[model samples]
Target: MKTLLRLSFAAIFAALVGCATPQVPVPLDQSFYTADKKTVGLMLEAPKAPGLALEGNIGLLDYAIIAAATSSLTDHIEGQDLGEFLAVAEELSQNLENEGFELVRLQVPEKAPKLAKFKDPDGKDTTYFAAKDHRTLADQYQVDYLLKLTATRAGLARPYYGFIPTDAPRAVFNVHGEMIDMSSNQLLWYSDIAHSAYATGEWDEGPSFPGLTNTYYVVMNKAKQDVLGALAKRESATGTLALNDDEEAEATESSETPAESQQ
Candidate 1:
């Protein structure tokens, strides 16, 4: 059991793209963060896709190999929500407030209410907002700026198993978020966010398999922390957000602190 756990740990860590893959402030418009913008509301919207399809051909042992390594192929696992989304929101809100930007918690509608996701005139997925209804929401909330976590794609499975270089277990995902001007309905910022936690060939956090929901839980938490760091402009550099400083305080302090639950 101990040896198996160690092997599994090695397998997971092997797949991690540690301390990289995210660029902060996400290269937003210069005007997004101005001198007088007071309040900002958060819209948490993202597609949760789990179990990227395995791509390749394999013989009999393939079945057992895949079975042992992956949790599910294409079952829409939604993976799991270890409360990372809410944590991200909470962190952002607090960060903005500390920076003198008022924070407003917007309610995620029960139904699809009025989504702001669509192709724009520029032939790009430039801005996706719910047109009139979203504007109404903005008006109702009285927020000056709206930040939307456009998409957070996370899961624990080898998406391009055959195409990738190595066979190791790592928590991986492609996540991005943006800021928007509700009045003009424009994209203010954007970035491709990624995070990872390489298992250390030991039961550091807990036992490990080839991959599991728990693996992503650990990974997403790290990702959520950086999302706040980037938006707060604290992690403006192109390296991992430094840990041994005051900038890391919130990421450390509030990680266990859950945001108000959402639907």
Candidate 2:
């Protein structure tokens, strides 16, 4: 009887181990190019604006604000909330500056009033006030172009039991951005980029968190680069044609027509 019991326990352990799955690795796909290849004004959206919604959440700014407020004082993630949208905007602005592009700073007002309360996991109400101040800042800065970006998770799977704490079959992120011509109130450019990464284990508070994964940055940078690149490409193409036209005109003048030569 004792031997049989031991055998059963061993079999169960083996089965659980066999069922474990390996974590999936994330991928990065990034590119930048211009369509017109011309120099144009580039302005970054205000970080304070409640933009870039994720999973029905208020937006990146709201998330950052919440994260900063809730984080332990000693934690690195703590402090004033800049939100994801603003963080990305700042990064892109720096990148554009480094590349020698003309950058315009715009201050667009927030469309929605700051929320007075938020739903916590424990069904408690959490009050927020910083958002109100940020909204005011957005209104003060009148920007020429508004760049709106949104991030959403399409799917999440349960974790496997054995080797790893979690194993998602697939994780998808939909990233999209729109360039709004504030003057015309029209969308001048819009594009969406989707990418998938495998989650090997349950996400923990660390560098490996899905949010920290470079995949998000890859998609965002590509989107930004795409806008600037198109403008740059257009300019390059136009300049080349202009130069060629000038050369041809000079050649024609040098080879005077017979009637003009006779004179």
| Best model per lDDT | 1
lDDT of 2 by residue, 1-263 (tens): 23223333554665688775422221111112232222223333432211111122133234344334323321322122324434555555655454444445443335654534322234243211111122232333344444555542222222323222233233333445555443333345555545444444553435334432333333333343333332232234354221236545854764483211000
Q: Against the hidden reference, what TM-scores do the models get?
A: 0.55, 0.33
Best by TM-score: 1
lDDT per model vs. reference: 0.54, 0.36
The digit string of per-residue lDDT tens for model 1 on 1-263 reads 23223334444554584545342343555455555757888877654344332323333345445545443322323434546655677767766766678877777666865655443556354444323334555667788777767444455434333334244445565566777666766656766677655444532232323344555665666567556656654233563543447756755777676432211
Candidate 2 wrong stretches, greater than 4 Å? 1-87, 98-140, 154-167, 199-263
Task: State candidate 2's TM-score.
Answer: 0.33
User: Lowest summed-lDDT stretch of 10 residues in model 2?
Assistant: 23-32
Measured by TM-score, how close is model 1 to the native structure? 0.55
